[model samples]
Target: MLKSILLFSLICLTLLTSKAQSVQWASKVMSFSSEYSDPLLGKEYRAIHILGRPSKYPKFSATPSAWQSLTPDNPGGEFIIVSFDTAKVVKQVAIFENFGAGSITRVDALDENNKLYLLKEFNAGYAQANGQITRIRLANPTSFKVKSIKITMNSLRVSGYSQLDAVVISDGDSPIEDRIKLEVDPNAYLVKENLGTAINSKFNEICPVVSPDGKKLYFTRWKHPDNLGANKNQDIWVSNLKDKKQWEKATLFPAPINNEENNAVCGISPNGKTMLLNNVYGKDGQMEKGVSLSFLLRTGEWSFPKPIRIQNFKNKSEYSEYTLAPNGKVLLMTTEMKDSYGGKDIYVSFLKSDDTWTEPKNIGAAVNTGESESTPFIAPDGQTMYFSSSGHVGYGNNDIFLTRRLDDSWLNWSIPENVGPVVNTNQWDGYFTVSAQGDYAYFSSVENSMGAEDIYRIKIPEKVKPQTLVQVSGQVINQLSKLAIPAKILVKSRVSSDTMQIDYDPYLGDFSFMWPTKKPFYMEIRAKGFVTRRENFDFRDQAKYFESVQLLGLVPIEMNKQYKVPNLSFIQSKSEISKESYPALDEIVLILQENEGLHLLVEGHTDNQGDWDENLKLSLERANQVKSYLISKGISVNRIDTKGWGGTKPLNTSTLEEKRRLNRRVEFSFFVVQ
Candidate 1:
């Protein structure tokens, strides 16, 4: 009898192993439903935990521990349903009952048509074990493939809820090895091209940063003989656009920018005048690493690099790489800070009024994952961001992803989309930057390259193209001397209320600003001993990609001299101020506050578009509107007087609409009333 029992046991085990190997299991879950879930173990785990591997520890439980089993709130008449992305011929089902094992009484399978088939029914005779796999073979295997499984549990003897550690299923057609292989879509297309010998050398090149003007490319090359340092370390190199698609031969940046120590170009300002470099220099027999800021002088030479001191960024590991937006008010960086979800997460810091950086905030999970994220690049538009991540599901090891800022809060972001295979591969891919026009993307790659790493350019896909931004660049000069004036340029957007202050190049008088969206903008130029100059930019129908040249000449403030307020627009034939006129009016309020002892006259003029009587009344009401705004700004009304010149004082006598538009203006003259 003993010999017969041993032979029967061996036969049963052989049949079980053969059946398990004959079927393929589903890899992805499509739907999960549970009648009730334990408060500690949420519904997600209660229904989907069976798809993952079993935990090693069965007796001990902890929050977020994989070993914890899924339990229902109520034990009687409870059910758990789980559906897979694809239908499979499930021949065997196994359940690991680590806790509350006796609560499960029956199991059923469902086909694609939602028709359920009974699989097994348990009785009190069934024995429960701690962390034991109980395999249930269907007595009458269904002819159709199964798409989902439903487990029902009911118990009267035990008041505790039903618990499950894991569930395993075996399909009838595919083996485990075939099921584990990942499938790549054959329809996906990604095309990459080399940047050519002019920009890439036999040595390693990486971290490409394109200037906002899209005429210059700056990058880091390692172990090159042209490096100033004898240590064969990294050095900064630059290449200028020679033609449409051709670049001049790469050359090392002038001294001080690329020293003997290891130096790498982190980023370049939108104007291409400020460069952020990472320098690893030795001091007191120890290596020191920090980011240094180098400004391009008016003489075409870089100033001595000064190390940037971030308030809380003390350790070297806290920051890995960073990029500055075109406006220089926002900084995007990759760091291994404590708040990071995993490896290296991206964070952003805003420039405070005192010129200090605010505390860096993590960009949130929509862009970060449990893997490393690095090499962030904010486009000129400032809304879209490109970065490399190993955490997000992508084509390869490290794929580039793009996301747009959803709101004013830095933490709010849209779901990150993979840039696609054309720019991403199974190998590491990152450090992506786009041109000012959002037409081409610049990045470093190792494939089909002249060196370990080479810079490459490719036309950006329309879907991922960043929103276009307009570069407003011009000169600030003195009206009297007709020479460059060192002044402060203040820009404010009427719609967004975004403000930026930039100082003109003291020697060159050149200043540049970036407008990220199509909105009205107000600009003010202030210089010592000069009347503040104000201008407006109306971008209602502005081209998506182009630069606007604005030349501002500041006049000396004098008595009985009138200065035209460039951008004050009123509703047609009415005194109501247009939304676009707020910035200019705000500037007038600032001027009044600064010149407290000065008495001013607010004059309103209108084009010869309407009846003379209506024009006169509209102009007077417009001037009163100005006075009312000034009073609202805490200015004393007695110091201001209003006058309506109407069509009598037209700046331009031409009949053209454009000339008439220019004639409609508001002029203010200041005088010292003793």
Candidate 2:
């Protein structure tokens, strides 16, 4: 009896599952309201396409030409009301139309009780010149049991007729949740707050870039009265953060940075000292544009913008918009290059050792589609990328999407996910940037706002926030003169050997670098006429967000001058040097090679802990060990001399272990010997 009852229960469960799997389809539309129908073809064309029937003239309809064209009585807006035989829960609707003529701009639906509901409104710029199909997902999935759909078309152009090739309605009653979810959960509260009137104006304000310190906000304001181009071009504007929530009134960037040309701010480095600006101008009767770089001088003035010449950017068609990764090692840009799925796609190029860019590679299909993708912003973590795409299934045209690098390769990426309705609306939404902390995102939107486009800030959802990043920053100065020097800063990943090189501000001596957390890095600071500085950072156990400030001081290369090697280490009490000491020794080898006429004396010292005689012997051996390593690196042995001073010259007399450790060291003194 128990077995019979169990079998009956199993049978009932299978029946219920099968019943749930049954997906219903709406019957063909009984009628449609049209202003003027073709004499040869009736309204049957609309119902036939919705019913998945083949077009009567498949060859001629390649450009979304309809079997019957509906013309409004006058040159204005018109609607086509498509009614179905039975009410169906519509999950999504795909509308096919001609690209060159009047197109559908809005859609509304009527429920079984004749109650109408507005569905979605497309932006004026949403349509392309090529015949294409747009899929509009209903905002409320549960409220889609509608009997009719009204597609409204605004005849903004001279064309009097709006042609509809087909309409497809996807029923949401299917047991499988294959449809793209559009509506946000009721409990999910995400609001996009305007930056307010202080920074936004009646003119267009876009491309917001917040400094890593979160103190300054920079953006581009177009058609402002203060613009140098008679309110026709764009200029960079900046505002300071007040109490974290409010912004001071924005002021136009001064002369050199904002000129008569169309100047716009694209990106700001993590240190807030370097900025990437787009300069658009007309040359030879054609518009020419490129991204220029500028530095913030110590005198609170911006340097003149200089065009960044990428070695591999010979093909102008492939490169459009670009942003530097926080580390400045990689450049993420939009390209219409070959092998792209279609239209403009996001690509990446790495900075090579020769200060040139590598050939750009597409970020892959997971993040791109047959439609256009643009405005890419790589977060400080370096792995997370936010961009805009019309190809992906999104809320509407050019919705913002985020994707993460799955691995070290540019092509390996996670599937792109829409950032959702809080940040993306039905209109054009793009140019998104996030703060270094990953808490708030700043982007331009065309919603109810102060201008045609205004900058807005929204708190990012915790789940969508970027991974943590750590910044390494400081000033590079001359040790003896205590004056700022122009230097090249190189940060290299110990594991991957990937390197990022940035130039320090010559006037300010300030430099900053950002990298994803939990990696070991080696940094080298090099400048002419001075000894280079090298340091290492191990952040495997560091907290999520970390900032390391290091003052890199360089000693001027003078005859008979001695400088302590910062990181040369010896094994406990042995003469053997640690492998971690190689980077420091390599700098010496580089200095010797660069200055062929120089001679070096390697001096080693010990703390005041061991026997005098033994310490002397050990220090001599350690000095010779470093000398031998330099010889192995092709430095002439005759150019180097070694010496040892036991405990006679201790750096620190403190009894603390950490203080005493600093007393044991290796020093290199160089002189010109003709």
Candidate 3:
């Protein structure tokens, strides 16, 4: 069974005096009879996890790192002993059951000097449906000073493992309630700011999707006169970032963008040429139940939004949402399918080779709970994802949290971290968007409102913002003509299998990659009649917030033309290849493998600083190594040749290290083998 959210949250306390005292949570987990095994939270339900405050929702958890029994019963007896730092004369004990509500059968207080006092023995009824705290009222306070509390639970009454998030003991017979507060890192909490009257009216504005380039803001407005639904339903609106500071006056999207139904923007491409809009808008202005795509026409008008196909697409919930990946190859949506974990779980559907969406798959327990998870947005950096979930521990209602995609598998995600209470209120909070800058983030909130849930912005706290990444941007250029060429770039990461393919505008010849600076990556830039140029990029050592600019030059694959290998590097003054250079070499092997008749000569060169004799020998060794490695991959030896020009060839005569590094490279020359 899927271990779910909170059930019973447990805490023990003793009355100090007639004066009302603060509630005390379990300060330490002394021992547990048994524990459940849950790999979803990326951790075990250790007894130590039960110490301190409750970190999950109200429902009983198989885990949110809470203590769950191995079976409903712990053979000898199922119980956990928790202690507080200070002992007090106690009266009432309140148990917080996040999961398996009312499963706790008994409560015992441990006094100083070794006396265990009975608090109350519960009947073990599954009272609450989700997570609820039950209070054990006592007529008289304890006479002795109590330092610890013991909880005994029965798994039989609860169905499965009863999860415990925390236990609270209060003094003076007051009710003990441990409210959840996100622990934002010090100095890492962003101050939320309202977007003001220019964008927000007394109506409603929600679901803000920031453009990848960070210049435009797309959102949904409700009950506004400009809305196409005649102020009856929601419509999509947009605002431009004027001078990088203020947002220009909001304007409702003209026809095709705003329809009679609930219209909104789910995703947008970096160039703002294509958008994944909510629902399919037909020619007659009526809408369907699925998502659609609209293209920006050359005339600066949006084309009609047409429905996109998703195999077996079904949403049980009335509300459905989606966000397109920066590359447009992946899409995330919130829906309830037959296999949904609960009310609404976040699912992913990939854009297939045939242009149809594959069936949506559950993203797993890491992000979804028995509750709802919605309004997903992937930052332009590609890995960081922000969404609102009631399943994870947060303030009341829905709260926005950020989690990163760990690997190529959408299932592997870092534990979702709350975005803090600044922007997330006790009310509904969702629709988070970030740009390539990874600095500022925007969301919608009902508080500090112009009317409805107004749009808000915050300087992303460094702790919760997308990891610092370099925005690799440039245009494809012809090596011979020195002119821009419309091109396509297939970017592959050295560490992840997630390959993002992007196209440069045919007119501008420009493309960009919002790549994490911590990882090494290489890209294949291809255009008609041109040799696919492979360039390696590693900005791992670059400081935070540092973005790089590069010009990718491509050459026509013609006779006697030599193209330099990119991202390939050898250890300083050595012929041995750095492991980082393997991917670049593999690219060459791939090109050759694709063209069976292609033969190649690998030439190695050294910087002018190196001694001629030593550089000559070192360069030759490097070229031979490349050839040998290729042969190991089953390439024919007769089809390969090698040479070295130590300091004899220089891309430039500059003395700076940045420029000097250009001369230290391997170059590829191709010939058609008869």
Candidate 4:
């Protein structure tokens, strides 16, 4: 009797399992055209959104997942191919089109081997009006089984965009209920892509650091024969973003930067001129446990890595990582110390005036957990911080998390949130870095790597992306020589009062920095045998700027020569000062104040469109306005002079309105007040 009852129980269990498995949905999206790049958008437009149960029709389509093909979006063809997890005898198949309907012209069913033999075609179908829960059932109680389905849609048939919410399959012909239970898929977007052979080798490639321009990529390669330390230690390798947007073949750096000991790139300045390395390099190519900087020299080669001394710098752990903030004022390190909360914690050190860094301060418990926290990277915006930890709740052994600084104190930060399941993983996902644009995040992954580990990058949603920043570049020119000047550029934020110094590349007289502020930012350019020039870029009113570029010219500071003030106040030929001119005038005032021995001459010019006498009078009034402004800011009135060139001294001979407008300008001249 017991044996009979056990057999009956086994039969019942098999039946239940089969019944549960019979209700299968489109498990995967194989091919799609005109899909949204970001998973959050293109409701019904993204083909991947149809992976599970139907979304019970679209009320407001954007609120739920749906697929939409761009209208006139992809010219030649429009189609989607979806496959199921299990092939079962199908009683009915449903296509849920909630929004712009009747784009479907044909549907095909494939067998287990992807052989398309069964299909249904519609004749000259036009778009139908939007309907609630529009379920089009095809092939009910069919003779054979199906593994996948293909859908062909035409936006031309539909006057507007078409939407597809879900494609479901059931073993029985009866319609699927609205509340049918479906399998939960939390980490849906696990699109693990390999960075390809150009960056990955049979060995391990980790610690990715992409340049701000998004053109250069740097990573650490270990256990490779080409490594300087050979298999035992890792060395830095670089690749260029070539034509077709593919990364070029990676090449290893030689001696100076990569010695026999382990060498890695902890940070790269936005200008691509400075790099922070993992270990301190000796003049003789020997290395020690410390941090160093390798600069791009005038010869176009990397300079020997020089140690950057930090007060009371010590790491209890053999493995440690560090990052230099884009502003060049802060250094982030992940190390174990006596005061660490646990295995490892994130700490910050600030750059001092003496070219050294202050002692490391713990980042606080909000970000660094009781478990290890490694690989900290602060975005160009400075507020958003990314780090990896095993202690935080995540989908992997080690995952990357992003947090924002709440106030001036770096200790106060929002609770760390996992970047996402796709970016993080079941295995270790760290050494993450982003370009200034913050569109793609480059990271190291061991899974599917060409060798032990490989570098990969993925498009991130805009919500988590770093705040948009402007890329500002300029050259430091000598007053007399008219040649490029290698100088110390003092960059400061008026809002945060944060100051940092960056070196100008003398060879090209070129310098670059990221501008993340929506307020006044100043750059004080200083070079040997030349006067200092201060430049201010005010973005207070124009907060809409994003991923923009600004090119600045030479620092004009010759004794008797004139430099255009570039104040836009005279653009309308009006004497009333615009707020745009305030920053420019402030910059001049700062330069004068910094050099107490300097006296100033303010000159204004106007276009030839107006009468010479009136233009001259207006110009003089403008110069007086500037002088009065300077005096209001504490400049001595006795040391300043005013002049007006007017229409007689037009810069351009052209009669065009635009060219004539260039004559209306303000200029500054400096001399020693003897």
Best by lDDT: 3
* Candidates 2 and 4 compared by lDDT, better number: 4
lDDT of each: 0.68, 0.68, 0.75, 0.70
Task: Give the range of the ten consecutive residues with the poorest summed lDDT in model 4.
Answer: 1-10
Task: Write model 3 residue lDDT over 164-218, tens digit each, in one string.
Answer: 7667776655555433433444332247788888788898889888886778888
Better of 2 and 4 by TM-score: 2
Per-residue lDDT tens digits of candidate 4, residues 369-467?
Answer: 445789888877777888887654455667777777787657777766667656766688898788887677888877667768778888865546776
Give the candidate number with the greatest TM-score: 3
Ranking of predictions according to lDDT: 3, 4, 2, 1
Could you tell me which residue pairs clash in candidate 2? none
lDDT of 2 by residue, 1-674 (tens): 00000111001122223333323222344455443333432222232333321121111132211323355334556566666556777777766553333366788888888777888888776765434555676565746587877777666643444455445565542322232334444432247788888988888998888887667888988888888765468778889988857899999888777777667777888878778776433333222456667877788888766666565553325337778877666777776654554456778887777766788887764666545678898887777888887655455656787888877777777767678778887689998888777678999998878868999888887656887777787888899988878888888888884567787875665577777666688888888778988777887776566777888889889878778886775544667788878878888887887778889999988887879998898788878988999999999999999999977898899998788877678888997776
True-structure lDDT of candidate 3: 0.75
lDDT over C-alpha atoms for residue 125 of model 4:
50
lDDT for model 1: 0.68
Superposed model 4: Cα runs more than 4 Å off = 1-190, 229-232, 476-506, 517-674
After superposition on all CA atoms, what RMSD does each candidate show versus the true structure? 12.6, 14.4, 9.3, 19.3
Model 2: how far residue 443 lies from native, Å:
1.0
